[model samples]
Target: MDSLSEQQQQASEKPIINITGEKVALGPIRRDQVPLFYRWANDFNVLRTLHIPRPSTFEENLAFFERDVEDEKRRTVVHFTVYDRASLTPIGRVDLEEINHRDRRAEFGIEIGEPDYRGRGYGTEATRLMLDYAFTGLGLHNIGLYTWEYNLAAQAVYKKAGFREVGRRRQAKFMGGKLWDIIYMDCLSTEFVSPVLSKIMVPDEVRS
Candidate 1:
């Protein structure tokens, strides 16, 4: 039997959406990249909305990279580090987590760790690129995600990427000694087939 590598599959197939003038690239996380990711995960601004544990040691972060990324079964839970093409550096990561092939769906998760990287539209662009890869490259039916209501910026990014708010879980998050609502959003392949999103996402230079 012949098996297609992930890169091969992505290159040969069509994607559900392609935001113009932007591209999303992925590769195995390097040892050097681990420290970068660790720094991002530890930053209070970036982790504020994440259900992550306390700041991780470099060793702990390395373990996490091994588990969620290296051990990921390519069939489900594909992970990728988001990179800025212009600057040629990893800025963040986006993934299709908890994928269910039987159901033909998966949940989306993303984070741009560098505080200097936030609010410049890279998050949305990275997301659009991933959505295209998930729907078109992987032949999936649905992609969805959950975000806290307080994360208005992230919610806006999701909305710009074609994810529509479909439901909400009241008081679903308890972090920093407080409860917050979790909003669920999703977009169908048909709903995201158009190129309407280009207007909402434009990239900025990655901070040095």
Candidate 2:
């Protein structure tokens, strides 16, 4: 089969759901999905919101997959492929990186690479699910993320997921013929009530 057909076939298969949500599910990132990641990395619409905001080659994406595998093994990062729960189609990615178990904190990052999936509630659902995993599954106390000043949509999503704007780095990024601040937002385990993990982790007696 041709590459496009093969990708579609693979995507249609039932994915191993790690964290389920209302509108989306999180699954392990597969090696076969590197081509999709490459396409998203190169898409300007997606890249513009990312911290680096640069086109990535396929080889670089391959290298990223390899590195992600190692990082996951070392427990320094946790990555997931965001899937549309209804269609089971891969739409984006969300990850908690720079994990410090001792400090109980990590940096959060997410991208809805598929433009069709943007402006929907998928990203917010995915973020909440990740937060549940981070706080309850991994016992993390704090999770932080950054976004450019121009990305109002992302800020709203993060806020809806329990993150509050803590600060900003003034004129930290130059894009689209203007400089923008790097806005910082974060949420603590105390501030968030786990939507999924708590039920699984806590006993009925303690929960009541």
Candidate 3:
């Protein structure tokens, strides 16, 4: 196949958006996109920010995707493929893991694997949309995340999206010949005002 045709074919297979913001959209993880996920998993630049310690094989990523599907069915985790809104390009992923309905809490994680998309405000917007879904759509009360101290950029984004530093695990992560603290931050439903879900949750009668 010609390069242009292949590109067109790939474009047609883009995942449909589930949740959207001004700059980014969150969509279901498509089975066909496991290869893309596998690519991200092995990107050392991306892995440095995330908790992944070693390179992952394509088969391992496939197995992980299968397990992830089962977890979604059990409602133990919620994952989304992050897309660039303007181009509808798959750029990364975001997820709420370890969800406990009784406790009303979960752990948040995000990675903008596409180097081109890094440093943009997309991550911050995506974080807000996920928080809205957790607090309002899913009725989750608290969302927490852990970031290495070296990941100052992620910490800034989390703070912008309403998370506050609850505590820290000192010198927990060793990388680049140095030890970095693991920063724990969380956002409470009471402290956040959902940008999207709030409007949906309001009574129409009240508006009238």
Q: Largest lDDT belongs to which candidate?
A: 2
> What would the C-alpha RMSD of candidate 3 be, to one decimal place?
4.1
Best candidate per TM-score, number? 2
Task: Judging by TM-score, tell me the better candidate of 2 and 3.
Answer: 2
Error of 3 at 116 (Å): 0.7
Cα TM-score per model: 0.77, 0.90, 0.90
Clash pairs detected, candidate 3: none
Q: Across residues 42-123, which tens digit of lDDT does each residue of candidate 2 receive? A: 9887777885667679999999999999999999999999999999899999999999999999999999999999998999
Q: Show the lowest summed lDDT stretch of 10 residues, model 1.
A: 12-21
Instruction: Return the lDDT, model 2, position 153.
Output: 94
Q: Candidates sorted by TM-score, descending order? A: 2, 3, 1
Q: For model 3, give the 10-residue run with minimal summed lDDT.
A: 199-208
lDDT of 3 by residue, 114-207 (tens): 8999888888999999999999989999999999999989999999999999999999999889999999999999999888778777665755
lDDT of 3 at 194: 82
Distance from true position, residue 61, model 1, in Å?
A: 0.8
User: How large is the C-alpha RMSD of every model relative to the true structure?
Assistant: 10.4, 4.3, 4.1
